[model samples]
Target: MVRKAVLPVAGWGTRFLPATKAMPKEMFPIIDKPVIQFIVEECLEAGIENIIFVTGRHKRPIEHHFDINTDLEKHLEHAGKTEILRNIFHISRIINPIYIRQKEQLGLGHAVLVAEPVVGNEPFVVALGDVIVKDEKNVVERMIEVYQRFGKSVIAVFEVSPKEVSQYGIVSCRHIERDIYILDDLVEKPHPDEAPSNLAIVGRYLFTPTIFEKLKVTPPGKGGELQLTDAMRLVLEEEAIYAIKIKAKVYDTGTPLGYIRTLVEFALQREDLKEPLLDFLKDLLSRDIPQIHRT
Candidate 1:
C-alpha cells in the first residue's frame, strides 16, 4: 500500500516575481484557500498517510499554515464561530505532515531524493506542489490504483499541443488499454520534430523505492541539476513503467498566467462567488477600452 507521499515545495517562484518574493508559491491562495491546501485535501481523499513536504528556507509559512493555532481557535470559540473554527482545525487533522528541508534548489529528482530516509524502502507517490488535478476521481487515487494492480511505476500523462511539446517531458509508449500506456522511453523538453510522442508527463508519480538508486546515479542535464525524467529513464531499463493519460483538468499554478487561469476557474465554481465574479467579468469585458488592447 502506498501510504506515504512527497510534496516538493522548495522552488523560488521566479515567474510570479514580487508576489512570490515573500510568499511561497505553494501558499498562494486560489480563492479562499491556499494552493497547497487543495493538494493536501486530494492526498487525504486518496488515503495518503504521511505527507513528506520537501521544503526550503523562507518556507516557515507553509509549516505554520498546517500547524494548529490554539489562540485563534480559542478566539473563534469565545466569539461563537464554530464553523470557522472547524475549518481551521481541520487543516492539521488531514494527515500526518512531515517537514524535510531541501538545503539546495537542485531539482525535482533531488527533492524526492531528500525524502529517502523517511520513505525507507517503500513505494510512494510524488505530487508536485504547483499542480492541482480536479476531477470526480482523485488523480493520485487513480495512479495508486494502477500502481497496485500492475506492481510497476505509474506516471500520470496528458496530451499537449505539438507546438508545446518542447515545454514538457514527453513520453514514448505503446497503448495497453484505454488511457493506459506501457512507457518505452522518455525525452525532456524535446523540440516538436524531435519529440517521440505528444503525451507529456504531468506532475503526479507512483515510484518504487528502487528509483532512489537510479536517481543517485543520474547525472545533471541542461541545467546543472538532476532531472526526474532522467532518473525514471534509468529505472525503465530494469522495471516496467506505465503511463496513465489523466482524465482530469490539471492546473499548473507555477506561472502567472496559469495561476490566474486556475484562480478564475476555481472561483467560478464556487456557489457564492460565481454570480458576482461573472458579473464583474462581464462588466470589465463590456467596457470600451481600446487603449488596453493596443498596449
Candidate 2:
C-alpha cells in the first residue's frame, strides 16, 4: 500500500508578491479553508496514512495548521461551537503529519529528495501544495489505482494547448489503455515546436524507490536547479513509467489569477456563499461604466 505521501510546500511564492511577504502561500484560504487543507483532505480521502510535508523557513504556519490546537478547541467548546470544534479536531485526527525542512528554495526534485529518509524504500505519492484537483474520484486515488495495476511509477498528466506546452513538463507517450500511456520521454517547458507531445505533467506523482537514486544523479536543467521531470526521465530509461490523463478540473493556485479563479469556484459551490457572491458579481457586472468620448 502507498501509505506515505510527500507534500512539497517550501516554495517562496514570489508570484503572489506582497501578500506572501509575511504569510505562506499555502495558508491563503480558498474560502473558509486554506488551500493546503484541500490538498490534505484529498490525501486523506485517498487513504494516505502518513503525510510528510517538505517545508522550509516561514512555513511554520502550515505545520501549525495541521497540529492540534487544544486551547482553540477548548475555547470553541466553551463557546458552544460544536461544529467548528469538530472540524478543528478532525484536522488533527486524519493522518500522521510530519514536517521536514528543505532549507533551500531548490527545485521540485530537490524538495522531493529531501524527504528520502522518511519515504525510504516505499512507493510514495508527491503532491504539489499549490495544485488543487477537483474530481469525483480524487486524482491521487486514481493514480494509486493505476499504480496498483502496473506496479510502476505513475504520473498525473493533462492535455495542454500546443501554445501552453512551454509552460509545463511535456511527455511523449504511447497509448497503453484508456487514459493511460507509457511515458517514453519528458521535456520540461520545451518550446511548442520542440515539444514531443501536448500531454503535460501536473502536480501529482506516484513513484517507486528507484526515483530517489535517479534524483541523486540527475543534473539540474533550465534554471540551474534540479527538475523532477529530469529525474523521472532518467527513471524512464530503466523502468516503465506511465502517465494518466487526469479527468479532473485542476486549478493552479500559485498565481494571482489562478488563485482568484479557485477562490470564486470554491465559493460558488458553498450554499452559504454562492447566492450572495453571485448576486454581488451580477450587480457589479450590471453597473454601466461612464464612457470617455474621444475627439
Candidate 3:
C-alpha cells in the first residue's frame, strides 16, 4: 500500500501576483475548500497515512490551517455551535502533516528530493498542490490501482490540444487500451509540432523509490532548476512507466484568470447564490453600452 505522499508548496506564485504576494497559492479556495485540501482528501482516500509537505517561507498559513487551535475550539464549544464545533473537530483530527522547508527556489525534482530523508526507499505519490483534479474515484486511488496492476510507476495524463502541447510535459506512448498508454518517452514543454505525443502529463504521479536515483543523475535542463521530466526519462529505460487518463476536470488555479473562472463556477453551483449571480449578469449584459466598447 502507498502510505506516504508528498506535496510541494514552496513555489513563489508570481503568476497570481499582488494577492499571492503575501498569501500562498495553495490556500486559494475552490468552492468552500482550498485547493490543497482537495489534494489532501484525494491522498487520504487512497489510504495515504503520512503527508509530507515540502514548503518554504511565507507558508505558515498552510501549516496553521492544519494545526489545532485550542482557543477557537473552546470558543466554538462555548458558543453552543454544536454542528460547527464538530466540523472544526474533524478538521483538527486530520492526519498530522510533516513539513520540510525547501529554502532554495529549485525545481519540482528538487522539491521531491527534500523529502528523501522521510521517503527513504518507499514508493510514494506526489500531488502538485496548485493543480486540482476531481473525479468519482479519487485520482490517487486510480493511480494506485494502475501501480499495483503493473507493479511499476504511473503518472496521470490528459490529452491536450496539439496547439497547447508546449504548456505541459508531453508523453510519448504505445497504445495498450483506451485511455491507457505504455509510456515510451517524456518531453517537458515541447512545441506543438515538436511534441512526441498529444498526451500531456498532469500534476499527479505514483513513483517507485528508484526514481530518486534517476533524479540524482538528471542534470538541470532548460532552467537552472532540475526538471522532474528529465528524471522520469532516465528511469523509464529500466522499469515500466505508464500514464492513465483521469476522468476529471483539471483546474490550473495557479493563474489569476483560472482562479477567477474557478470562483465563478463554484459560485454558480451554489443554490443560494445562483439566482442572484445570474440576475446580476443579466443586468450587466442588458446595459446600453455599445458592443464595440472594448472594456
Largest lDDT belongs to which candidate? 1
| Displacement of the residue 103 alpha carbon in candidate 2, Å | 1.2
Per-residue CA lDDT of candidate 2, range 1-295, in tens?
A: 9999999999998998888887999999987799998898899999996999999887889888998989999999999999999998998878799999999877999999999999999899999999999887788999999999999999999988899999888988999879889988988889999999998888899999999999999998768888898899889889999888986888999999999999999889999999999999887666775553333
lDDT of 1 at 96: 91
Tell me the whole-model lDDT of each prediction, alpha carbons only: 0.92, 0.91, 0.86
Q: After superposition, how far is residue 194 of candidate 3 from its true place, in Å?
A: 1.4
Cα-based lDDT at residue 45, candidate 1: 89
What is candidate 2's TM-score against the reference? 0.95
**What tens-digit string does per-residue lDDT give for candidate 3 at 1-295?**
7889999999999997777888899998776678888788778778886899999988988998778898999999999988977866776577669999999988999999888899989789999998878677688888888888888899999878888899899988997887677898999899898999888887999999988998889899877997899999999889889889876777888888888887887789899989999998778877887873444
Candidate 3 error regions (>4 Å):
288-295
Q: Lowest summed lDDT over 10 consecutive residues: which window, candidate 3?
A: 286-295
Worst 10 residues of 2 by lDDT: 286-295
Better of 1 and 2 by TM-score: 1
RMSD in Å for all candidates: 1.6, 2.6, 2.1
Measured on C-alpha atoms, candidate 2 has an lDDT of 0.91
TM-score of each: 0.96, 0.95, 0.93
Clashes of each: 0, 0, 0
Candidate 1 per-residue lDDT over residues 1-295, each given as its tens digit: 9999999999988898887888999999998789999898898889996899999987889999998889999999999999989998987877799999999999999999999999999999999999998877788999998998999999999989999999899999999998789999999999999999999888899999989999999999768999999999999999999999986888999988999999999999999999999999888777897754532
* 114: Cα error in model 1, Å: 0.7
Error of 2 at 190 (Å): 2.0
